[model samples]
Target chain A: MATRTQAAPTTWPHLGLGARRALWAYAFLLVPLAFFLAIRLAPAASSLYISLHEWNIISPEKPFVGLRNFQTLLADPRFARAALNTVRYVAVGIPAQIVLGLLLAMALRRVTRLRGLFRALYFMPFVTPVVAAAWVWQWMYSEQFGPLNSILVALGLPTLQFLRSPGQALYAITAMIVWQYLGFQIVIFLAGLEAIPRVYYEAAEVDGASGWQLFRHVTIPLLNPTLVFSIVYSTIIYLQLFTQVLNMTFQDQGGPLASTLTLVLYVYQLGFQRFRMGEAAAATAVLFAVILAITLLQMKILSKPVEY
Target chain B: MKHVLALLAAVGLLLGLASVGATQQQVTITYWQYFFESKVRLIDQLIPQFQAQNPGIRVVHENFPYDTYNQKVASAVPAGQGPDVINLFYGWVPLYVDSGYLQPLPTDAFPVQELEREFVPMLRNSRFDGKYWALPTAVRSLAMFYNDDLLARAGVARAPVTWDEFLVAAEKTTVRDAAGRIQVEGFGIAPGGQDHHLIREVLFRQWGAAPYSPDGRRVTYATPQGAEALRWYTDLITRHKVGAIDFFPGANGYRNAFMAGRAAMIFDGSFAIGAIRGGTRAKWGVAPLPRRSAGGEASNFGSYWVHGLTVRATGPKRDAAIRFLKFLVSPEVQRVWLERVGELPASRSLVSDARLANDAVFGPFIQGLAYSRATFFVDETAQRQVLMDAVNEVVVNNKSPMQALQEAAAKEQKILDDFWTKRAKKQ
Candidate 1:
């Protein structure tokens, strides 16, 4: 039978018309691939190239100074502070948003009355304009006239400089970010929660499991994918903290002592304010690398197949 | 087979037709500005007037809110999408100049020397690099606007001419409740704010110094005069207790408090003249800012000048733009700018015209313009940010005046070094 097959000539090599059809199918994908290359990849690649040069955007002449812009950025104390602030924002904000999101989701799952209305109310901030929300936070944090100060004074508590204190500004900004974005994660968690089968909880109840026992044994294990989703999404968003801090801080002081200055704001200020486009581009590349690494790690750690 | 041939024929026709429709049309010149309510009216009014003046050319006017104008302009200029003429402040000149985004206004082209000769010297702060980069359309300066009814009630006859007399008036004007809580402050100056520009300018001149060196090249505020200016401002809140941060609740809260008659005296710029008059029910009068010390010189503070137009070097419609620019700066538009918008006209001739001089609110604003000085530093950003930062440190953080000034000077020096080093290397 093997000899007969060999003599008949491999059917795969004889399939010319099928191979030609496959080539046409591959050619169709080239449109989207070309678009991705043109819009996204081209700019990123150009930014990487430009980062190695010393360029004033309007100058008639440009000369390459390999990695000098990066060197300058590294040497600058402000950049280091900005990096630390960004790390702190991500480290503190991501976990808080996820946990809070999950808890709210669970609570919402159990509620039967006005669930739709409550869901919409909770999700409002997620859909609100970040700039407008930031401005609202600024009003709330207003030292003298804000509602927060009024409440504090009424309670006989010392009025805190929420955005004015360098020490407190970063955390205050992070809290605002978390407050604004938590609703989004909550909605995501809700969708994940809805996907879980009711039979698992029933089975746990039949097994004579307590409330905590059921959650610990069955819920936790089953919600692994949801937890992974929240983690990965929140990590990406938290690392790019900018809008709230930029709007809240006075133009002169990026932070009280440059505390709330994030990587994205720094890139914008350097490129636009300082006219250091090359340095800004390099910082952007670094930001991209950071996001890529975290995303890869998430996939590796959370991609295990589950046994139901 | 017939359907396939027809489809191919239609596709071929569409492709063939698409190749023929590519040609550049009439050039559209973009004008970017930050327009107030009144300014918007004038801008709208001028479009037809401008079009009538230059028939062939089309001007696309873009307006933005006052707050984000600077950032928007800065970002747009480098991308080749910036307006042919941008309404900008004098402080933005250095940044645009450094980046080579601005085309210099030659003396011969715009007759800047003639405009300079006609415009007030104080308003000439917009000119830079020994050439005009911007035309001053409207000038703003610090002036003392008081509630006449409140002043009369407080038993003060007129605006104080000297610092000591001002304090005395403030003391007489302020009122407190039974609990010793301040019910009415003598003056409403927002404390805990960075850079009280109007107040600082008056003090700097009183001490016989300016914010920066005359050349806009170094830190001149570190001198004794600048330190004296710093102290005088600090004393207004800490010592005199006339104006306090605690009194002004938040940003612009002091101004609102003043309007509400909680404060007897308020020092601000011309921009507030219209708002103060309209926003409040109280009878008000305007006066020049109080002098520093008896016989000591005083400077007008808080000159917030707007940007005028400049024709781009490579622009095709240079002649059309120049004619349009001239008309925009003419006395007719200046009158519209003054009467309609309440902006102080940049032209000396139009300002001296009887119409503006007769207005009660603008009279002092115009008078104060003669003494006005632009805040200048080697790095424009340093001049703006460092000063504001220092004020915040002193007023909000309660740092000593000398310490704040010293810290600001150090920051300014570092910025100056960065700017000069780059320039030197280029040379």
Candidate 2:
């Protein structure tokens, strides 16, 4: 036993061929690397270059105007409104979605039979296509015959102009977004909850710790990893929000007064609608930076080093 | 080794035969269009006619809702999977043209000049940037649609002819609850939706202010006449209490409001005539838009352009596409499309036919086309968005018309200035 403990493990000296084979395996990855560079990196780099010039995509001539597009965007009132709306969406919408998701996950965890079925039902909205989901929501939010307002009227309550009101339009759009993404967060939280060792809960119970105390001490600390994930993921998604506001609104005005216009929508409108591709690229660059910072900040605030 | 080689040779021969068979098959032309189910069925019936007219070419149709059609085209075209032929709105022509996605019609194939004589001046509305990007499938104009029963109830004998009379009629016809909130409005004008027509374009004509300058270089809406026209529309809701700030908000259609007796009168286009029939059982009458300030040489026509077919600049099938376009524009096809979908025929000769001229609906429709003026197709996106924003600010937000127009003009001028300044460097 003493000799076994003292003896050094034999190191393979003749495995040079295997190491060389591994190097060859790494080189084989060049195909996928090239694909990633073409699809993601190349387009990103091109967008930055194009952003410096005034290009209308199809125009025979492109006039290179340095920093002019950025200056024009700074002067645009629409851009300011869109930025404010985006900030508001990420601030309010993300937190609400995460909290609702966590609560849903806790409730679902208690179901013993057909738990998978219940999980599927809750995940359905997240899995549904964005276009179809948005259309259904539009119908539900319809001012005249939508089931939502109709029910309100039936209850002898005033029918709210959900999308048509300047004050309510942004909040209404946020609610739809939250509803769609909350299920995703819940699934993540549920997986995290399931992974927690049950022995700790049993030990706390035997120690005479109440439900609230156990949750405060054991559950909250253990769920930090999942909470961080939810925060970072939701932040990135909410920052890049676009399609929801585009399809639902009317008058191409971003409605009731540019209330629902967000950053990505603004970028899209600049590039596609206004043909200011340079400014659109600049806006997209800014959006990427903002998302990156938010995700980093979230990680810094929520992440905890696991102790062995 | 010999047996494996024999099997491989057999497989190669079979694959060659299959490839040859595929190449020899009929060319399926994908046609993406925006039409309702009824029009789709009618087109399906007409497809056999087209197929007979052109041998070996089979047309496959894919349809989408009008709202999503352009978006679908935009995403699909870039992927090289777009339809061979597409129906596009006239307003969107500038965008398609600028993107270099569209092909100009060959002069030899369609004979634009020969077809021009067959069309009315209003049908020439499809011209943009000195090029005919689209051909008007049919034409329509904004007209006063009124509920006869509601007008009768309100003791108004006839439709209002002038602005002052219209206000009086609206005031008379309007009903309110005990709370003094509007219940049954006399005229349904949604500042958000139809304000451009109900207020701006109509009043611009009445004030004798050209929507664009004579040179088509700048917006002249900041002139005194344009300001007056703008104020007149704004004052209707603020002072006259005749219009609604949120008019029929949500999913309520303005035309449906009139048909359902929710409002006695509404301003709408001929495209809305079909939808109105399904909204209510009320007897309705169509009339001209109320004039600006009683009998001041009434100008009462507003128009929107329909899509035209064009051949691509660089496509192997340009000739075939133009042939299809010509066949589609024939008088017989025009009549069938117009009759089925309420699309007013662009052909001048077709409009005056006894069948179209005598039909109660088409009587006003054709008459209005004569008085109609097409909206300017501004190539500048900044100016267009600013103009739209100004309209919303003036009409819906109840902003000062002068201030709004001034701001719009200044913004538009800056864009123009930027364009020229940049162009100088390029030269």
Task: Give one clash count per candidate, in the order shown.
Answer: 1, 1
| Candidate 1 residue runs with Cα over 4 Å from true position | A1-39, A53-65, A194-217, A250-253, A273-275, A301-308, B1-88, B95-116, B123-127, B146-196, B231-267, B302-333, B349-358, B377-382, B396-398
B1-427 in candidate 1: lDDT tens per residue?
Answer: 9999999999999887665344323456777788677777788789877876555567888889876676566556656576777776676675567656677765676776687677777646655667777666677777777877877888899888787777888888877643333567887765333236754466765677666666666666666777777777777666776665535434466677878888888877677777788787888888777776666675775344444444352556555556556676777887778778777887777767776676777888777666677665434543565676676677567887778888888887778777777766765
Tens-place lDDT per residue, model 2, A1-308, is: 56533442334334454675686787998889999999999999988787778776435445678888778778878888988898888889988998888888999999889999988988888998886787678767765546887777778778776776667888888999998998788899999998889998999999999989988888878988988888888887877788788766644446656788888988877777666678898788778778888888889878976552
lDDT of 1 by residue, A2-48 (tens): 77556545655564556757877889989999999999999999899
Candidate whose TM-score is highest: 1
Per-residue accuracy of model 2 over B234-339 as CA lDDT, tens digit each:
6766677665544443334555567668787787778788888777688887877777556565454445444444333135455455555666667787788787
What is candidate 2's TM-score for chain A? Answer: 0.89
- Per-residue error (Å), model 1, residue A110: 3.2
DockQ of each: 0.10, 0.14
Interface RMSD of each: 5.3, 6.1
